[model samples]
Target: MIGLLSTTFGVSVASALLPLISVELFAIGLVLKEPEIPWWVLALVIATGQIGGKLLHYYAARGAIRLPRFLRREKSGKSSPGRWRAWLESFRENCRNRPVWAGSVLLISAVASLPPFAAVAVIAGWAKVPVSTFLITGFIGRFARFGVLAAAPAAMATWL
Candidate 1:
């Protein structure tokens, strides 16, 4: 769980750093667009990073035993169940005894894929969502969001 929380934090921090990364990513391509990182590329990177982070976060939160001691802190005070229970409860409300856990997982996954809100994945994991379902839904949700981000600039570039 500690690893998952860290992964979530790291991913959030990464998302926050993306604009800076975008500058570099576009610079690497030697593109002269005013926006250093092309919107599509930025979106793709964000999507990919978040998806990977979420996967790691899920497994880490799932009590994967292979993680090293530094990675898995069984101690309390930080990233505790009580600390995050509210968020988990909020997420569960949406699930609300839904017949198909997959659907709930998809919705939660989509919510978590959004920047700044990706931490929701940790809460979902703590809720004991099935790994396979979580991964598939998360991937699709992240991809869909990236698709929107990728298409936005192309659609709006005419105005810019």
Candidate 2:
């Protein structure tokens, strides 16, 4: 059980940090292999791992940590801002105007991955959303998401 939990947490964190990895699929497989592990326990472990991994991006976006040169955005010396920069500026302004909506978007992305949770985490931090708010909403949303995902295999087995 300890080994399974550790593996779950490791995979969850790795998936969170790497866009190519899919924690959702991993959770499904884990459930199929270890039905004895409680679904909620799996959910909590995954949520903690994911949020912990994403916290690095949040901290970087919030300027608590500096990104290395490769990850940092290069300044465009052009007289006018580029299209992406302009759009980002506009989006930042909108987030500033409606704080609740910003938080809602973060929660929605965490659960549904509509806009991609990785980007949302950075955006949430860049927009100055409180760290406490980010962690609370992120964990709740991830917990809910993984809870359903981890239970899917058992649900399917019973139905079959």
Please name the candidate that would achieve the greatest lDDT relative to the true structure.
2
RMSD of 1: 8.8
| Tens-place lDDT digits, model 2, residues 1-160 | 9998999899989998898988888888888887999999999999999999999889998899988899888976789888987987777887889878877887899899889899989887787788887898899999999998988788888999
Tens-digit per-residue lDDT, 48-95, candidate 1: 566665666666665662678776667567554674567667666655
Clashes, model 2: 0
User: Clash pairs of candidate 2?
Assistant: none
Q: Give model 2's TM-score versus the native structure.
A: 0.91
TM-score for each prediction? 0.52, 0.91
- Give stretches of model 2 more than 4 Å off: none
How close to the true structure is residue 26 of candidate 1, measured as C-alpha lDDT? 29
